[model samples]
Target: MSTTAAPAGSQIAEITSSDASLRRFLAGLPGVDQVGAEARVATLATRSIKTSAKAFALDLAIRMIDLTTLEGQDTPGKVRALCAKAAHPDPADPTCPPVAAICVYPDLVPVAKDALTGSPVHLASVATAFPSGRSSLDVKVRETADAVAAGADEIDMVIDRGAFLAGGYSEVFEEIVAIKRACVSPSGGPNAHLKVILETGELVTYDNVRRASWLAMLAGADFIKTSTGKVSPAATLPVTLVMLEAVRDFREATGRQVGVKPAGGIRTAKDAIRYLVLVNETAGEDWLDPDWFRFGASSLLNDLLMQRTKLRTGRYAGPDYFTLD
Candidate 1:
């Protein structure tokens, strides 16, 4: 909850409104030290959790998951099934908490919305040419509108990493600004929360990850995401650790709260707990909630459920007890 003042006539105020000024503000931020960051993550990853604490972490990880299914062959049936599983992850055990949301492609938003109706599981759609981000700006905005119209509660948009890497920070910033404008209600209020994916795998360095995190936040991202799950090295500990630190710093500098999601390659209960540990130790306890932090993965939920079952039943349930989505 700490905040740094954005004084009048300061760079913070200018960057908060202008693309050119935002570019300079991001560029002027200090570079990240890769070795130091990696070492810190490595150390934090070793923190051990015993019985009750482990059980708490397991359930918390489940609630923070954005159970995702983004495939070329995705169908309505697939989305409906995913929504059911998202709402009641472990049907046998009412103690198992529901996931934060069910993420799907933009086209399947209606299907997911219908399936998730009357449930706490939110329907999130990946819009703006996800995974590749090769579409035009107009197409991106239109797609986002379609998803919102289809009843998507959240919109996850990928930043143009190609443009970002080429030093077209202004273009990238402008695109996010326009997309934020697109995520509006019929009454002109906020419609969907915007998650800007940096696709950290393609960004190439921790410094780039840090810069992209700030860029997305400054551009009005409700959450800064790590990857789109189509890229390799998606959502690594070092990368996510950097993003968590970035949100922590951004909140202090601007007094604005931005969430963080680390998607892809997080398939085990231990891995999910490691991420929660990072959030607690690095981002503080303030971000431990599902609204502030989310894990975007499909398989990770099953692992967490299995572990939850083990905690409740005094035995490991293995993977067979849970339905694979």
Candidate 2:
């Protein structure tokens, strides 16, 4: 519940002691050899959404991303307008909820952090050579520190997925752990929550995704994310399901509540709903809140708003009504 970011050079406070049953569930389970495709997949399909409750939860987790590429001379105008859309939830379509965070690159963190002030919505920045975690450790650390100093509430970093797949898990893990250490806010109170991007498309197999997710969690990842918006695959349900289950497993092991963010290519209410179902069934109710979950999207807000407007007023609101860039 503390707002202060964790300090640099600080050790990742292990969460394994979250709950006894949770640990028991997370402990010494089989590594890839222990799982079977037929098992969870069959159940995964059965639990897919069938009611409004499922749809409602999906809307809550979809966090909007306004890329830096989209912000030019009108950065302030764009940010203010973005905040307004998120703050004023349309009552007509109550189910299409406003986003939890507005994501951007480190340079724009202040712009967004300031715009989101006084609202529950948090400001997140992609740091450490995002979309391509190919940079010096010093640069990554500074990038993270600068973003936090600029008031970013969350740090989303790409996991050197290429290294991990090349059997360099140590490199990937250490970078995340190091970045996590470097992310404390200006107050030096608490470290910004770390979201490690697997760039699942690059990770390839589910086995690799599973391995990367677990490794990042072990090294202090607060959230396991899929793709950098620049990736070809972005976020797919199967890949996301793997990440969500990993969160559940990590929580069970460390008693820590990690969040899940499926970034890239998620643009509609239906796609969001499928992810909601995946989380609800795999992680349960404890993970439902915005603190523990989110969806990375760029074009979802307008669609959600249009639908909400339609559902509420019985009149369709055109695409121009929402400005989610």
Candidate 3:
């Protein structure tokens, strides 16, 4: 629930004033040891929680979920159903906590907004040419502004991977800044939170992932996300560790805290618990809250629900017990 002011324009200008300066700053970032990172997460995955602790971890994971459904065939009926599920993840158990948010395409913002109204569950819309990040800046910004106008509580924008990989760091940086501006509501109320998707699968290396994480944070992204869920090898544990380290160190250096979301390929209660362990081990206990961490998956919620039922009722629920949105 706490908020940190964006870095001053002067501070951003010093590092991003030109392509050469931005390149130098990114180059100065320490390299990531792939083996060490993989080994650390592998070890952490083995640490098991006891009965009581497992129960708590399961609930925490439920609260951290950004229940998402993004598909070309999506319709109002489906989105509304997803919204209902997000607000009350387990209808049979009133004690179950709602998910953190509901993420959908920009065109369906109004449907999700109407469905999620009067609930604490947030409404997130993916913009800036989601999953591909190949569009004009003007178009991207306009889409973002339109989503905000349509009652989106958060904007999940994709970074220009082509520009970033081609060493056009300034181009990617400025796009994020422009989209951040578009998140501000025209009514001048609180700005919609911005979650910048790095799409790490296409970045190709741990060092590049580290650099992109920093660039997104510098450009005023409220949260740095791992993937768009459309790419292969999305949200690997090693990539997430590198991102967690970047956010932890960036806060120390700039005094501004940013959130991390690893979307795609993470399913089941076991996978969720391992990620919670990673956040605790790498970023400390502060990021354990739902505000700082999130899982962007549609099927992950069903698994979490089944696990919770097993823990509470001493038996596993049938897969058909829950609706498949």
Candidate 4:
């Protein structure tokens, strides 16, 4: 994908009305043109991504992990060290389990990749001017391409909220399409996976969330993410439910599988569990894999360890090891 600026007035993803119901719904709503941010989303994400014995045993288990310690120096050595810790914890907890992927910023993709050399933990980098998609298209694409070239196994790019809110669906669609093309991995075994963040905090209503969720999926998003964690109104169970429903609907319509990521403020084990339940109930068994579902959290790892340590050993592990991702 060439790094080019956006064409003025170009619409993003195309919305199709299969029937009267959908057409009426789209016609009645004031989409990107009439949205306003009011109440902030206060839903805190906890380590609730656990499953029942049967669900854990029978269904594919995906653990969402975070390296929430982004505050310190983001040097390569530090990143590599942290990645090593993520792959092989200082103290292994059988109950804590293994995370499917390790998420970090674009600058740290290589660090994470190097740190997780032989482990199954995929390196995921946040792209598209993450936490905010207001940068030039060229810059965004360069960031994504660089991250992938640096060895990121997955690319988590935030969508252009401004374009989406302005009813510019084509802009959003084209951006994702280009970014996905840019995500080719180092060896080219596979391009980095794309997870489009809608910043559901910005997409207020359930109807709009559902519509945008489907739009991102159609635009070639491997995963539909909830928020960027930078916004106050981040991921919420209710909003996430709407997103999962959208994915389910999209699956029914196109027979394609897509993923969902609920990021921002997911703190404890309980919160993660709730999201897992919603995904399990709404999207069925197909959406249960780490490849399809992820929790973009920075703090949940520690809480889960603490909980697991308490449960298994009847002692709480000190919080010194957990860092904010």
Candidate 5:
């Protein structure tokens, strides 16, 4: 499907001008078929790639990783090491592609920036009371600005699920818009890309996932992410399928193309490839690159490395061969 030009600013504004309009628009969205979605992902999961194609997929999967580390104990040294690993995933193999970006807590953005300076791997910071978007709007906005000022190429912000579930759609929408504005550099340079996390596990249903996806895109999110990796039942194939469908339809309506990222609980090479296939099948080949899709994972890189080694050398490498994330 081809993407047409986006509607004028006035038309976009009318849709989100008030809570009633936002609700009416969101309610009008087509409901998701839970069984059909689950069935589709189940069928897609069984399709296997072989030999040369598998190699390509492994490398591509490696390139799509965000290489994240967001724990309370994360130190500058840890952030630097993660950045180093992101720059050169498998140091012994020069052919191994670097990850798409390095995701860290906002406080560690400076450390990561220093480590990843001159590297192609983008630096991402989780802001806006990340993993739990339960803070004052002022605090969230300030945190987003701070991360951007400190050198974050991307900001992964969590939407207030409490407000969303309480039917405060306008509150969540306005909050996202405010944070999107905060992404701009103080000097008026390029804005840091915004990835709005739906935290799908908390969202409770596939229908809600679709609504939240549309809500985020409408509010100017560059990417609609599945989870923060903190919640249970994170980033399942069926959930990702719903999000992929939202983005595909979104692009058709708005000229702008949005991205999809399935974070948390996605660890194995097989799991990562399954997500790649899901994106290819649901969102089309337009999103096959790292620019349009990503896997927010940490241990996932090591697994992809091990699988890549097995494919190239005809044997599996021990986990010890790669650095721990």
Candidate 6:
């Protein structure tokens, strides 16, 4: 697979499709000091955000959420309920902003789309054999196209970590390129935004996380995501910090800004605050927007709503106040 040019007028790093070139680029990236990264995240986690700052961070986190439901038991009713929650997370307070997107299975795209009609919230679908990229290239491409046809505004595709771990750098890069191509509409225009999931929990090291982040960015991922939520240790603070650094460095190198989504296991207002702190300090204030940052979570919204209620009402609100979806 030859290196393709970045979308017209977009700022993207120039990368050769050759395996040797890709290896050199990966090798040239600065080595991540795990201890240093961990220490930094710990220190940032301690930053005292209170009162107005805490309130701002709370709402920002809500808007940055990619509310998700990916399960074998999902039905249209379930998806519609999730979509309603995404549109109005807190019905008690109209001030609460809707989440950035509602993420679901490809087959549920139409269900979510119709539910989200007349709202700004986007519909996202996980494709390319989510949680495990153990399918053929043709299958992955077809899955992406089907999602787009069904009305998904974004596609979250998981990379083949088995191949990446096997030192198949070129294969991983080519796979990303192929899926990126598949994101185009049938009418020959841009379709869904592509988010490449690295499943960093399975990558096992900060160094691998950094490398995978760049590889996905080089292949034109609109966003680089961290997990699928099926594995343990998903979306840890240290892993997200490294990815934030990767996006920061990639922007410095190519002038193109790629978003980051830390999915799974991030379920509390405090946990969400820690991640917001990491983004502010490492990725800078520029990434504070929902467009550049997102949290892929299912149960996280309820917690955020509960906290928001506390902030507004001067007392903690029970879970019943928020929708159970």
Which has the greatest lDDT?
Answer: 3
Local distance difference test, per candidate?
Answer: 0.87, 0.68, 0.91, 0.68, 0.91, 0.87
Candidate 2 vs candidate 6: the TM-score winner is 6
lDDT of candidate 2 over 224-312, digit per residue (tens): 88888787888887777677777776665556778888877878766666666667777787777778777777687666666556645
Q: Which digits, one per residue and each the tens of the lDDT, describe model 5 over residues 245-307?
A: 888887877678999999999999999889989999888999999999999998999889999
Off by over 4 Å in 3: 1-12
lDDT-wise, the better of 2 and 6 is 6
Off by over 4 Å in 2: 1-55, 58-74, 89-97
Q: Which stretches of candidate 4 lie over 4 Å from their true place?
A: 1-62, 66-73, 94-96, 318-325
- Across 133-218, the per-residue lDDT of candidate 1 in tens digits comes to 99999999999988888888799999999999998888998899899888886555558999999999999988788889888887
Superposed on all Cα atoms, the candidates' RMSDs to the truth, in angstroms, are 2.4, 7.2, 3.5, 7.8, 2.4, 4.1
Q: After superposition, how far is residue 242 of candidate 6 from its true place, in Å?
A: 0.7
For candidate 2, the 10 contiguous residues with the lowest summed lDDT are 1-10
Q: For each candidate, what TM-score against the reference?
A: 0.95, 0.80, 0.96, 0.79, 0.96, 0.94
- Compared with the true structure, model 3 gives a TM-score of 0.96
lDDT of 6 at 96: 94
CA lDDT, candidate 6, residue 127: 97
> How many collisions per candidate?
0, 10, 0, 29, 0, 0
139: Cα error in model 1, Å: 0.4
TM accuracy, model 4: 0.79
